[model samples]
Target: MDFNFLSPVSDLVLAHNALLSSQALGSKLRIHSKNQGIPDLDAVGIAIIGVLENRNDVNYIGEEFNLNEIRKSFYGLFPGSWSSVVADLGDIEKGERVEDTYFALKSIVSALLKLNIIPVIIGGTQDLTYATYRAYDDVIPMVNIVNVDCKFDMGDSSKPMKNNSFVGKIILDEPYNLFNYATIGYQTYFNSQEEIDLMDQLYFESYRLGEVSNDISLVEPAVRDANIVSIDLNSVKGSEVSLNQKFSPNGLDGKEICAIARYAGISNKVTSLGIYEYKPSKDDEMTAMLVSQMLWYFIEGVNLRVRDDDFADENSYQKFITLVDSQELIFYKSNKTGRWWIEIPFLADVNNKLKRHTLLSCTHQDYIDACSNIIPERWYKAFRKNSV
Candidate 1:
């Protein structure tokens, strides 16, 4: 509830909102403005906060940026048949130091999480994800993160933190809340061999760009298991986004990225979502519109969420047992949503993060593979990590 660090949305964006149609999303949102200050969050489900700090970016050269254009594009879009209340709490200006900005972000996100309100962050750099992850230190004992990006961003932990290396800090920092980390749309060339090896040694999950693009559904399981989801705009191919937002010539397309966003929104376990690494340019309409559409898909997915994970009632889900290499694998299919989940047996003697039996979100393909004597990679990773 302590939102003193937040600033009101700019007057220019508010003026644009005044001209939007009543049916547009802008008219329905509770917006913070110079005159109205912060809006009431009594029934708000999603609160959008923009951060204007990027000093931690490795490529930072004192260039300035803003979220007004993205806000304008979002406000101009019409809403779907949805009931979730949304609020725009406006921007967080850069503090004296980058660490100050991180502290402010962590405080605000932590506060929102306590209130059961999801914070949708629009950030100046991907490193801000470190702040969001730290927000979970006291909120949740175990945290699962799903990053939709082109690289692992696991730079050397011994060196200073940068946008591309913040994940290293997350792994090495105290409290040790991270239970699982997964990367979707990773390009092999973007990651160093050491980082790749480190990811494997830690038993973290990763999906390649080709694997994801071939079947976008591969992202659902990873995202559904996450508490925090961070998206890097540069993960999209250069042709799919504007020049300023482009980084790789080969990456996810706009539709693919939007699909990933929607999957994040549909996940019940996901508490926070962030889209970062935005750079403003003279011709930024395409990028802004794409970001707005991604937000729209996410909101749509939230509205479509169903409570099908409850497995206590035998009738609610169908259970399947299969043996692969003498290892009994248990899988459950939600009758309500037809979604699949594989159970990771609890290890009572081991000092592991998961204290009880855990059900990892998986695909029907995994069940089929298990029946054919193949253990799903995710199940193997979780089982291995738990054993350690």
Candidate 2:
């Protein structure tokens, strides 16, 4: 993948280029590499993730092209800090370039985890949450999951790209703690009775940006033990971000939005992050430019926290390897019967990908400490005899 032009190639021509190419693409700017190093950030840990590309009528989440500008514009913010993460996945394109963005993202996440780099995942739609969160789910326990969006995304019909609704579907589809739910920046209209009731029953917390002006209190608890943070740009008024589904004049102002993001970035456990609905068709230079800046601030906060002495060696929440020795075996369950079966009992553990995503929570308390360094452990209220 060339730093200048995207690969897997696009039929679109050079004449179509604007934002990043105009200023930074030429000879005047050069990406700082290992030898020279970046002026501000060393990029000890990072990866870039862009899952969305502007689509035509056939696609589910169709939005105009200008949105890609964020990637280009964001590079300009590159040197604003030291040890700030390098945006590694910028080469990933939207739409036709890749099939099943979720799968591709997992591969990228897997590679990064091996490197111990923090991944900053960009949009393909709010649906990116399912895959991004899924990548780290197997690594950490007591995860604090938070959704920063206006809509609860309760749509679960299962068709691809219903855009926002499936967000609820995936969370429900997977088994994360419902008690971990916390939402911010939702206006009154976006809340429904059932959604509220569920949140209440689970002790889920939310703050309506409409009524509260600067309730910074809304952001804290959601990140306490979080190993990942899911950011939906639509959490702010669509007026602030063109990619938003519902734009409004009543959204949280620019200052508050960054503060919240910065706050989220400070969490010790936030490993992977995603930002969605960056549809360029609805965007302008101001919107495009501002978002890139917002990203810079968020990264800055994460960098500061990561660089701190306590967290310096704790970048990734993922730990240990499974099927690690030639003596160990890897297995899977039958799709229909759901019964565990063994495979490859005598393979070397030189580099096992299976261990990267399998979290272990044994029925016994002693199991927690035994596997604590490798498989993340948790205390379960109820134990399923066969569940791993």
lDDT of 1 by residue, 138-254 (tens): 999999999999999999889999999989999999988889999999999999899899999999999999999999998899999999999999889999878778787999998
- Model 1's alpha-carbon lDDT is 0.93
- Show where candidate 1 strays beyond 4 Å: none
Angstrom error of the Cα, residue 290, model 1: value is 0.9
- Taking the tens digit of each residue's C-alpha lDDT, what string does model 2 give over 278-322? 656544555666667667666766766632212124332222223
Candidate 1: Cα lDDT at 281: 89
Clashing pairs in 2: 40-81, 40-82, 48-88, 48-89, 67-280, 238-247, 324-349
Lowest lDDT 10-residue stretch of candidate 2: 376-385
Cα displacement (angstroms), candidate 1, residue 260, comes to: 0.5
Estimate the lDDT of model 2.
0.50
Per-residue lDDT, model 2, residue 169, is 55
Q: Which structure among the candidates has the greatest lDDT?
A: 1
Cα misplacement distance, residue 74 of candidate 1 (Å) = 0.2
